[model samples]
Target: MAIDPKELRRCLGHFTTGVTVITCQGEDGTPHGATVNAFTAVSLEPPLVLVSLDRRSRLCGLLEARAFTVNVLESAQKDLALHFAGRPNQEVRWAADSACGAPRLDGTLAHISCTPWQAYDGGDHVLYVGEVQQFHIHEGRPLLFHSGQFHHLGGDHNPLLWDDSADGPDAGVSFISTLAGTRRV
Candidate 1:
């Protein structure tokens, strides 16, 4: 009747997720953050997002007090991810989000600023649903986390593959031309 924690973690590791570092500033004016993989787009209608944090983490208190920013790291930013996730002995620098005052890492692929919408108790972790007030996208492939490691996407050694089932060559060309607006020479 009981489930094994190791097995549960191993099973969940099979599901790949984009890595992000969620950050906020504490009341004492200190920045706090943690490497998080439990973030996702909740809804488009209201522009919502969700990030789960362990109740005991220092970042949880900051998130409870003020707004937060989710900095989605690109594949090139794997060091940033690992740095934030590393031991407390390592020093990390964080810049404040100009719009919301939350802490954010520089040169992220994308940043989403949000106000806390609602919080629900999820066992040891609390799920904080946020209403995205502002966001910005940049050009880069996302850093993927799976099987207890960070994976780089879309490189010479690891190229992106389109799902063939989605369309044929003609459809692909049309889609690219429509998106790009023209062909070069």
Candidate 2:
């Protein structure tokens, strides 16, 4: 039996995700974007990321084998997200120049530019994987989404698990070592 679409969406909504605007240049060389939450870091070896866009979205067609920027939104950029999601905010800002051939949005938490790596059919969505070309990060908390609402990071314990350190659970060996001490193996 087919699952109810609303039920599926409600179940998926439990998974919190970072908000982003996937931007690409149109055929006319103008910037176009869509607010996307289905973004993932696919690989680190070649530095790949993936964004799933609905097959009907114009941004999906514009991204065919082209460069794009995944601008992770800051906590304060909910209006920008709404704008790209089709609400039309006239005062939306743009960066001075393009990054990796795609227009960059201003005041984002992070900007990751990429060239098209591959595309795959994802039912009603198309998963576009991109090879990392350039990226920038600013010191700020990310915008988040969950359960059909915009959210933000909370004061959780030890939220920053990894950092610029040479140590601290960096490998499987360290995890095994920690477990070995508590087990009689």
Candidate 3:
């Protein structure tokens, strides 16, 4: 089916995601980063993570068999995000270069360092898998994005929402329907 790109983007944007800056060194040994939200934890046994980059992105070209860092942005780091996303900011805070030789931004919520694990063609994008080497989590609220805008947490964290709910994903569809007072026809 021929899908409208705009419509597809809109639909996809409904899903909220955390913002991150994928950092790596250029061929000249200079630090570089790209603002990306297309990142996820892929596995546990071998500690893998994934980031999808546009095929045309300079960072995509630089990631082949390279080491990189994923800097998870906190709510106050929107300007940093904008900077890596191609909008120049007056200043960016750079942490000490990571073990992987990639620069990390200071004041981020988390930093995940990785070495190139695998790569796959993802149509307009390239899926890059990284074998996690090190990770650090800091205390801060994550920067979130949805529907073309940035968002903050509502400060409502219900730890029991899933653990104590019969309608949770672990309960199966029937339990969800029952909890909602609905039934299949």
Candidate 4:
């Protein structure tokens, strides 16, 4: 069967993922980044992560040469995500990650410093697997992406399904159902 690119993209959109702005400083000493959702935790023993980037991205070469930082934005940071994802002509401001010299946004839920470990050619994109050298997690709900939009994670107003009915015996079932149907975003 012939695969339609548009259809493929739309189908992939169904899988919700957290949003992150992958940042790095170029050889020219300029900060560069792009909004990315293709991120995942690869290992926990030594701490590792994987982020895929389109080969044609301006930051690709810089990311290959130097260390990089992944700033996981909080729900309130939707503007930052949109900024980094903006056109190349737009301006962006970034600060340095002290441990690795990677660029990081001012405020984020978490910041991870990593050294490029492996780069594999993956069709139109390059898979960048990194070894995490250091990381910091702050208290805040994460910014999520689903169906091509940003979403806030938490609030007192949103009650847990199981907690909703104290007298209900189907709490466990309700919890599982909620988990299965709820997208991260």
Task: Mark the regions of model 2 whose C-alpha exceeds 4 Å error after superposition.
Answer: 155-160, 163-185
Q: How far is 161's C-alpha from truth in model 2 (Å)?
A: 2.2
Give me the displacement of residue 112 in model 2, in angstroms: 0.2
lDDT of 2 at 79: 89
Error of 4 at 47 (Å): 1.7
Predicted structure 3: lDDT: 0.88
Superposed on all Cα atoms, the candidates' RMSDs to the truth, in angstroms, are 6.0, 4.5, 5.2, 6.9
What TM-score number comes out for model 1? 0.79
User: How well is each residue in 52-148 modelled by candidate 4, as lDDT tens digits?
Assistant: 9989887676789578888898888777888788744434555556487887877788989888888889899999988898888999888988887
TM-score of model 4 relative to the true fold? Answer: 0.79
- lDDT per residue as tens, model 2, 1-185: 99999999999999999999999989998999999999999998799999999999999999999899999999999989999999997686889655578888999999999999999999999999999999999998989999999988766723423322333455333211232242211
Off by over 4 Å in 4: 87-93, 154-185
Task: Give the clashing pairs for model 2.
Answer: none
TM-score of each: 0.79, 0.86, 0.85, 0.79
Colliding pairs, model 1:
none
Q: Between which residue pairs do clashes occur in model 3? A: none
Measured by C-alpha RMSD in angstroms, how accurate is candidate 2? 4.5
List where candidate 3 sits over 4 angstroms from the true fold.
156-185
What are the lDDT scores of the predictions, listed in order?
0.80, 0.88, 0.88, 0.80
**Tens-digit per-residue lDDT, 1-185, candidate 3:** 99999999999999999999999988998888999999999997799999999999999999988899999999988888889999998587889988877788888999999999999999999999999888899998899999999887877753221223443555553322333454432
